[model samples]
Target: MAAAARLAVAGHRVAVYERSRTHGGGVGRLAREGFAFDTGPGLLHLPAVHRDLFVKTGKRPLEQCVEMTQVDPAVRHVFADGTDVALPNASRAGVVAALDAAAGPGAGERWSDLVNRGREVWDATRRPLLEEPLREDGVERLRRDPYPGAARRGLFRRAAPRTLEAVAARELKDPRLVALLESHALAYGLDPRVAPASATVLPYMEQTFGSWYVRGGLRALAYALYERCLERRVEFFFGAEAVGVVEKDGRAAGLRLADGDTAGADLVVAGVSPGRLAALAPGATGPSAVPVPPGRVSVLLALSGARPEGTVHRTVVHGDRLAELDAVFGTGAPGTGSYRPTVTVLRPDDPTTRPDDAHEAVTLTATVAPHGRVDWADDGVAAEFAERMVRAAAAAVPGLPERVLWREVRTPAHTEAETGAEGGGVPAPVLAGAGGAYLRPANTTRMPGLYLVGGFSHPGGGLAHAGMSGALVAGLVVEGADFRGSQ
Candidate 1:
C-alpha cells in the first residue's frame, strides 16, 4: 500500500498484517490451469487519484505503469424490446448526439440539458462526499435531515437533491432517458424512490472522466502495489486474521488474532469492516460493523475465451425500459421487483474501456440473488442463474454461451468469505446509504501507534483507492504527514 511503502521509504520499519494468505487482498488474480482469472476488482475509471499516490512514492512513471485513453460512448444501453442507447464519455454535446442517434429531435436537446444538470450536481458533491472525511458532529449540526450538507453550506443548494430521475425528467422530457439513467438505481440499491438525488454523480463521473484499466489485467494493479510495498521493505504477516484490537488508555497498541497471537504496531490500519473493528475493542462501533442492509448481489463472468459480441469495458445496458430493467436486475430475489444487468468488458490493451481488436478474455457482471440468506447449498443455483443471465444477454448479442470456456459465480457468501469485502461488495459498498462521508471509517483508529488502511477506510473502496489509502496511512504513521485534513 502507498502508506506502508511511504513509511518504509522514510526509513521506518513497517509490517503489513493480512488475514488472507495472499498479499494483494481483494484486488488480485492468479493464473491457474492455463486460465488467468482476476479474483477481485477488474475495472478502473478515475486515474488521477492513483497518479497522485504514485508520485508520492518513486515507484515508476504513471504512464510507464499504466496507459489511459478515453472511452467514447462509454456504455451502450439496450432495452428489452431491442431499443439501444449509448452513454458517451464526451460532454453535454455528446450526450445530445447519442440521444439524437437513439431517440430523435428535441430528445438530443433534452439530453444535453440533463447532462448539464448532472454536471452541476457532480461538481457540487464530488469533493465533499467522495474526497473529504466527515466529522460526526458535523452532520449532527446539519440544518437538513439526512440530506447533503456541503452543497447547502457552499452555495450549491439548488442542486442539493440532484438525482438521476429528477434531473433526467427535467432535461430529456421523455420517460426513456429517465429510465436509462434511473436504470442505474440498482448500483445504489435504491428504487428511484429511496436513492438520493445526489448519486446522479456516479454516472456523471463516468460520462466525464471515462473508465480506466491496467494492461494485462486490473488485478495486476494490486499486485504491483503489493510489490511496491515489498520493495520498500514493509514487513508483512500473511495468514494472520485480526480478531481484536488492543486499545490501552484509549489508544491503539496492536491487534489480537483469532488464534490468540498478537502483532504490535505504532499505527493500525484495518482495510476490513468498520463494524468488525468496533467489535475488536470495547464500544468501538462504526457503520461497517452494523447490520447489513437489504443489499443486492452481483455475478461476474470470467470467460476463458472471447466474450459475446456486444460487451464493453463499461456496462452495455441491455433491456427494454425502466420497468423491464427492474424486472431483470431485481427479480432473482423475491419481492425485489427486478434486476438490471450491465455488461462490461475489460480490454487490457486499451487502457480506456474501448474494445481491443484482439481481446483474449472477457468479464461480465449482473445483479443476482443476495448471498447471506439464499440457499446456494445447491451449486446448480449459480449455474442456473448464469444460464438465465446468458439468455437475457443473448437478446442483445446472440451466440455468447458458445464462447464460454469456464465460469465462476461469487455470491454474497463468496464476497464476504473469499474477498474480505465485508458485505455484498465484490466491487462496491453494500449500503449506498452507508456513505455520504461517514460511509468510510478513518485510517487512523483509536489506538496509539496503530493505523488502518485499505478500501474500507477514508477515500474508500476500489483497487486504486485501497492502495492509495494504504500508502496514505503509512505516510501518516511513518512520516507523520498530514493525510488527515485533505489530500
Candidate 2:
C-alpha cells in the first residue's frame, strides 16, 4: 500500500500486488461479518513518523481526518500474584512503585535508571536509526557509533547478549521483572536471552509520548491512507498479486502478475518482504533480494460485544497466567523458549476502535514462532488457541464467553500469508544468533529500480514507521538518495 501510494504520488502510476484480498491485512482490514477491527496492532505511538508520510503528499493535515485521544497509562498489567499495575507514559516513578510491589524494594529506582538510560540512547538514535534509512552496513554502524546520527548499539552488539534472558540478567535483578521486561522482546522475534536491550526504549515512547486511540479504529487509519492515495490519484489494485520480476538485460524493467498480466515501469517498489521478492526474482545472486527471519506470532481475540469490567482506555496486559506464558513465549534461556504470549484489552469509550455501543470487543495476542512452527490450516490448532486465549481474556472480564458474539483468530502463519511480512513479522527486525545486520535486508535490493518498504525493510515495523519508511524509500528511488546515513 505504501508502495502504491508513494509511487503514485511520485508520478509513477503504482499498484499493490498483495496475496490477501484485503488492505493492511491482519492489522488493518477485517471481513466476513458486519464487525471490523484494527486487530493486529493495538497500540500506536510516534505520530511524527506518520505525519512524515502525509507531509510529503500534502496530507499533513491528517489530524482532521479522525478524532483521537492520547491515552495515559498506555498499559495496565495484572501480575501473577494478583496485583494490578497501571502506569501512564513516562510514569517512571509509578512504574518503579509497581515494580517494588510486584518484585522487591529498590526495584522502582533501579527501573527508573534503566529506563532513563534507554531513553538517552533512544533520543540519540530515534531519528537516525528508527526514522531514516541506514547504510548497507547499518547494523555494524549502529554497533560502532550509535549516538551522534548513530544509535547506541550497546543494547545489541555482535558480541553482546542478544536474547531477553541476557538483557534481564545484565540490566534487571528480579526474576519477575525480568519476565516482564523479557516479554517485550517478542516484538522483535527474539527470546529474552537474545533480544536487544535497545528495544527497551520502545515502551518509553508510549510512556513518554503516549499512545493514541483514534476515534474509530486502525482500519479507519487505513481508510484515511487509502483516501489520501485516492485523492493523490494513485492507482489502486484490490487483489492483484505480483508473480515475478520482469527483467530485461542488466537494468530492471517491470513486473509480472499472477493474472498473467505485466506492468511496465522504470522502477519497481516492492512493498512485500525482501525474501518474497527473492522468491520471485529470476536470478540467484546479483540484484536479488535477501532473506529475513520470521517475526513473532500472536493469538488475537475480538469478543463480539465484550469488555473487561475494569478496563481503562490504556492497554491492558494480563500477566498472571504463567503456565500459558510458558506455552506461548517459552522458558528457554532465550535459545530454548518458543513464543511470548500477551493479552491486550480496549476500553469502552475507545471511540476509534469500538463500535457505537452496538457491540463490545476484546483482543488477546501472543507472539509465537513464525510459519511452520504452528499449523493454522488445521482447525484444531486455531480452535485450541482461541479457547486458551478466551480463557485468559475471561479473567479480565467475566462472562465474556457468554457475551462473545464472534471469535476472530490469526496466527503467525495467517499474518504472514495475509501481509507477506517476513516471518509473519509486523515490521520488527529479526536477530539472535549472529550479526543483527544480516537479519535485516537493505533498502535497495540487488535489482535495479527495485526497493523495499514496510516494517521489514529498513527502520523496522509498526504502522507509523511503515508509513514513513515508504516515503524515505521512495525518495531514495526517485532522487538516487544514499541511505547509509539513516539511523
Candidate 3:
C-alpha cells in the first residue's frame, strides 16, 4: 500500500494485486461478538517512517486518519524470579531507574552502558543498512561485525562476541538481564544463540523510538495506509493473485493473474516471500534466500470483566531460561521438555476493542515453531499450547483463564492461509553482522523492472521496515536506479 501510494503520488499509474479479499496482508483485524483484536502486530514503532509516507503522499497526514498514542511504561517484564519491571517509553533515565529497582543497584548502569554501545551500532548502520539502497560494499562493511565492545579474553587470544547470546552472557552478567536482551530477538523469530551481536540494534531501536498503538488497534495503521493508497487513485484488485510476472522484450511487462488474465504494467513491485517470488519468474531470485523463521500464535480473549485502570498496554512473562529458547528455535517444533514459552500479553486500553466498558479484549502472543515444526492443525496440540500460554500469561493478567468469556486461537496455518507464506513463518529483519548473516533480499532483483518490498526484502521485517521497503521500492521506481533513497 505504501509503495502504491508513493507511486501514485509520483504521477505513476499504479495498481495493487491482492490475493485476499482485503488489504493489509498480515496486519489484519478480527471482530467477534463486539470484541475487536489486531490479528498481527499489536504495536507500532518508528511511527516517523509511516508519518513520512503520509506526508509525502497526500495533504492529510497520518494523524488525521488513525489516532496514535505512545505506550508509556512501554512494556512490563515479569521474570522467572518474580521480578517485575515496567520500562518507560523512550526514557533512558526511567529505564535505568526501573532496572536498578528491579534487578539490582549496578544493573541499571550496565543496561545504560549497553544501550550506549547499541547507540554506536545504530549510528554506524542506520543510513546504509536502513535509509538507502543496499550497496555490495556497504553490505560487506556491515558484515565486519560492528559490535563496539571487545570480547572477553580467555587463556588464549581474544574472541569477538559473535552471537546475541554471547553478547548478553559476556556483558549483562545478570540472568534476568540476559533474558531481557534475548527476549528482544526471540520476539522477532530470531534464535538469540545464533543471531548476530548486531541484533542489539533491535532493543535499541524500540527503546529510542518508543512503542505506539493506534486508537482502535494496530490494524488501523494498515487501514489508514490502504485508504491513502485509494485516495492517491491507486487501483486495487482483490481476489486477484498474480501467478507469474509477464515479460516483454526481456523486461517485466505485467502480471499474469490466477484467472488466466494479465494486468499490463511498465514495472512490477512484488511484496511477497522469497520462495513465492522465485516460483513466479524463471531464473529470477533475490539477493538472499534465508530460511523462513517461525510464525506467531495469538490467543484472542474476549473477557467478561472490564479492563483494569492503570494497566500497562503490554506485559511479557518470561519462562524457562535456555530450554524454552532452544525448544522454540532449535527444532522445527517445540519438543516435549520442561519448555515453558515466554508469553506477551496485550491489553489495549481502547474502548473500540471491546463491546462496552464492562468487557475487555485481551490478546496473548508467543513466537512458536512454524507449521512444520508444530502440528497447528491438531486440536489437542493447539489446545495444550494455548492452555500453557494462558497459564504463563497469568503472571501479567490475574485470573486470566477464568476471566475469559471466549477464546480464539490463531496459528501458523491461519498465517499461511492469509499471507501465503510457505510455513506461515515470519521473517526477521536484517541485522548487520556475521558476514551478512542478517541480510535480506535486496529490493532490486535480477529480473528487469522487478522489485521486492515488505518484510522479505532488504532492510527486513517489522511494520517500520515494511513501510521503509515500500519507500525504497517507490524511489527505485520513480527516480530510477540512480536514486539514493528517501530523505
Q: Which candidate is the best by TM-score?
A: 3
Residues 167-202 of candidate 3 have per-residue lDDT tens digits of: 899889999999899989999999988888888888
What are the candidates' C-alpha RMSDs? 5.2, 5.0, 2.2
lDDT of 2 by residue, 232-319 (tens): 7776676788878788775567778888999887777776665676677744224533433434434433455644445666444544
For candidate 1, write residues 175-197 as lDDT tens digits: 66766667555443444543555
Q: Can you tell me which runs of candidate 2 are displaced by over 4 Å?
A: 3-11, 31-34, 97-105, 137-139, 144-163, 282-310, 314-340, 351-358, 421-434, 437-439, 482-487
Candidate structures ordered by lDDT, highest first: 3, 2, 1
**C-alpha lDDT score of every prediction, in listed order:** 0.55, 0.59, 0.88
Q: Which candidate comes out best when scored by lDDT?
A: 3
lDDT of prediction 1: 0.55
Could you tell me which 10 consecutive residues in candidate 3 have the lowest summed lDDT?
Answer: 330-339
TM-score of each: 0.80, 0.83, 0.96
**Backbone Cα, N, C clashes tallied per candidate:** 43, 46, 2
